[model samples]
Target: MDVTGLIPDFGNLAFTIVAFVVALSIIVFIHEYGHYIVGRWTGIKADVFSIGIGPVLLKRMDKHGTQWQIAAFPVGGYVKFRGDANAASAGVDEGAIAGLTPEERRATMPGAPVWARALTVAAGPVFNFVLSVIIFFGMAYYQGIATDPLTVKQMAPISGVENTLEPGDEILSIAGLPTPELAEFGAYVETLPDESPLDYTVLRDGAEVTVTTLHPYPAFVGSVTPQTAAADAGLERGDLILAVNGARTATFEDLRAFVGAGDGEPLTLTINRGGEEMDVELTPRRMDLPLPDGGFETRWLIGIGGGLIFEPATRAPSVGEAFTGGVEHVRYIITSSLSGLWHMITGAISSCNLRGPIGIAETSGAAASQGVPDFIWFIAVLSTAVGLLNLFPIPVLDGGHLVFHAYEAVVGRPPSDRAMRVLLAAGLAVVLAIMVLGITNDLFCP
Candidate 1:
């Protein structure tokens, strides 16, 4: 056996496990704390608040008589309220509540008002959403929004192209075409001719000047999506695509056209990274991309985003603007997630899109390897997904518990203990089946 060959694989596995645990632990803590705090506020006492399941590794008693603990497994967490049957809070602990007085009974989860119980169960998903919003808001505030008029902040170096644009130069026109508003620049770029060394008219030092430079939208790699062909091929930011299978690529549109034409065939990409050239072979992946007008389009993509030849100058956005952007980001994720799930269910998209624990761990490792900013962004995205998933109306989940609460509210009593047990068991089976399907896809899907 060649033991040395397995060393790199083992190291990568370890890194992925650590990254996955770290990300999952943070999200789970936030979710479980939401239940704990809200339960406390509603006069329901949480007997145990554990960040993980299985045998306890660390434990502490808080002043409120709640035992805060960390367990062996780091996969998930839960809050066990007073007089609950178990961590899932499926039913009341009849033996524990048998001797309690009226005042003490009010502290148990089952003894609380229907509204209080509902709020406590609903808080977990709500907190996950709040964490995502906070992360998005902080990122937006830190990055700042692009300034209007598309002024150049810094030029990205391209190996074989001459860049005459300078910082603070407000772009006025490109190749004799008047520049459009910043919001319309992307669509405007598509209308430009696919050629390099174009005429760039800019406002330099309060005077209009004409300079020759590479096309505004060149074959430059701005970002790479994790767990995709480009990332797997070791593509990095700022790498310029010089050619595709001996065909020259001057603009990003040319590169896109080449990839789209490939139809998932393997291509030889001539790349320029920091003045050095190399060849990379990768096959484009077929993807179902969501469109702006609430539909999806199929495309072959290598999973890299292109950008202009220079970084645009930016301005600090107002607090309200940043917060609004954060909210919109969350909303978009929620909507797109729902749409994707529906498409998968309806056979409009591939079921392979449903990723399991392994897929998420791989993505976690990839994101961490990219850098802290990318890792944080991945966490925000995963948090949104986690929040959305928990809201599904399935048993053994927060949403299922909310439904039970609703039933109790209308019937003036909770479901029978036997019926509750059966429904919860059925929900557990549905959840496990989904998990199995996801894992199967992770193992078998491309």
Candidate 2:
């Protein structure tokens, strides 16, 4: 177990608490508001809209007689529809609507149409998804899509190369394909065999020229962290590792394998810097990195990041494209999450992949420390997870209600009150058990 896992720093702990609160509050508000607004639209009255649970901190009665309030806790929230037994809307309040007229009774949760109740319950998760999509679309719009008029700002140095590409050379085509953008060039590269020589059409000095270049996956340096062995040894951006300890490394993976095999020993490196060959020596440092399961593992590192084959170039996408990208992003997350869960169930992966509230709080703080954009992106990701989780076909979840609705539709009536009570209790137990398991993993996993 990592030392940080046993005891966290005070400053980090404070940030974690604050970030977790903010994230939870946003997600819960969006979820509860969905139920409240939809219920109102469906002609069912809502008695209260509350963020968090327990004692109310601030309350205001809307003109429509709905009590809006903020409560003491900030973990989760609920919306209490009128004439409901409790906030979960599990059953109806018979006494509350006993003497009301037909029109008045129809405006209460107990008297609303079956379809209206279903819609109201389903809205919570749907709204969470919508929030994620909107955030994703905003991120897409801000970053835009990468395009190409590919110009070489810098070239990775490779040893034994006689003809080096210049900085001003604009690559017009590769392998007989008219590469107008980086995306096309990347696709073309992916199709070709590694380390093979290819012909390229380049625009240099106001003229087009054809050149033959090897497609070797050199250890291209993308970044060097301060105070690291690589940085101290004078490695710079765009430098390429031609050989490690006199052995040629054709790919970044090869370099990693060699470094990781070392027992924190010094490494001999043959670097190619702008066609110039040089040698350097550096020792790998052991660093601990966080894991998804709320654990950490130490790894040998030179503090260098590699494998960026393109420059930063982006173009503004159309509104339609932005929305499509957002939807695709959410879909990707849901697909991957379900796939992971299935793999875990089959024992193909470790169960430690499950994270609890503590893990989420830790992640929230870490993301916040990175920057606002990073934190917002993290929030969007968490929102997507929340929405997807709520749709699991377990009792007490929105998906469970949906399943109940489907059953009622087929049988022409809801489940018996006793049956509903039993199912809800069972669901609550399963949910709590999962939470406990997650917390256990966070505390004891290695």
Candidate 3:
């Protein structure tokens, strides 16, 4: 390991903080705007429209008597009804607009017609979903989707890979795993050992053929940065990271998270190049990466990108199928996200992939650097995730509120206040549990 690497420059922490705040604020605004516009349409008086939590930062009163303000906790914001003590804590008046008659209170939230109330609550999440679709279509109409072709990008002169799996052969599946796209196929290939035999089924000239071949990964035999320790383990270009310790890997991110704080000793890697899975070992070297507080912390670096090369940078999606591709891309991503969450629960997928605001901020900065097309794509992905997450059946969220509204519609009236309180409590617990799990995943995985 070269121990003489230079320090990392996050460039500036203030810039990152500002960027994160802006991104989150925009998302929140769109989400809340959806509810506000719909509520107004339903003739419900919104007494307060707040950005953030805790205390008020700034305030302005509209002609409708609604006070629009930015709050102290900037992380969350809400809309308060005429009679609401708070948005989530509606119906319980501790002194705010107390002593009003049922008619007056009805002007508030509790007295509103059931359908009106439900629609108002549903607008927040609906807005989120709309925002996602917009982002998806916009990004797609701008940058064309990535297409995975059946043709070979490279071939081995002596090993005869072209002989086994010819160019223009449409990939069907690996073993039983379906290869729907190039990204999925890439994951499958990366999961294989560098030179190990892999079963691949492809459609070529109206014929299906199964072939065995090797997948190559780049190893760091050398590094300009002293901290990339993957080089020290005798790993070099053409070596693949098939498995970590004993766990199978399918993506670059997986390999990274799985190997964080990597045992500190010589860790083994399975690499395949010319139809062979070879065992290699290496120790990581530590170097500093930029942190949030205008400082740096030492972390391990591998000094290598990966196998199955990245395509050259492109500008935008094609004029023809860009929108179609974009929509399909968003749909597929949303479905995979739900499945991924389910798998996390079942232990088939690791929860370490759950990223909080901190992680999102870091990624946002990276996407920005990549260019507008990539950044827009990132927004679409994240917006879709946030939209789905809000739809989870947990109280304190729009989805949970929708469930209550649905039940009230079925049973003829709203749930009891006590019941609502209990449900909110339960919902709060679920939120906390998810937060704890995500934080734990971050702390332990790396």
| Highest lDDT model number | 1
Model 1 lDDT per residue over 57-158, tens place: 999999999999999999999999999999999877899899899999999998899999999999999999999999999998788889788899888766
What TM-score fits each model? 0.95, 0.74, 0.61
lDDT, candidate 2, at 379? 86
Residue range 1-446, candidate 2, lDDT tens digits: 56464325787678889998998899989988999999999999999999989999999999988999999988899999889999988888999989999999989987887899889888988898899899999998887775567776544444444455566677776666666556555465555544435567889999999877645344767666533578557687667787889988766767888899986899998987877888989999775544455334568888788853433346788999999988988887777678677766776666776778877887787567656877888888888899889989888888888888888888988899999999999999989998999888777653
lDDT against the true structure, per candidate, is 0.89, 0.78, 0.63
Question: What local lDDT does model 2 show for residue 197?
Answer: 51
Best TM-score among the predictions, by candidate number: 1
RMSD of each candidate relative to the true structure: 2.5, 7.4, 11.2
Reference-based lDDT, residue 218, model 2:
49
The superposed Cα distance between candidate 1 and the true structure at residue 406, in angstroms, equals 0.3
Report the Cα lDDT for residue 220, model 3: 17
After superposition, candidate 1 runs with Cα above 4 Å error? 1-8, 157-163, 205-210
Clashes of each: 0, 1, 13
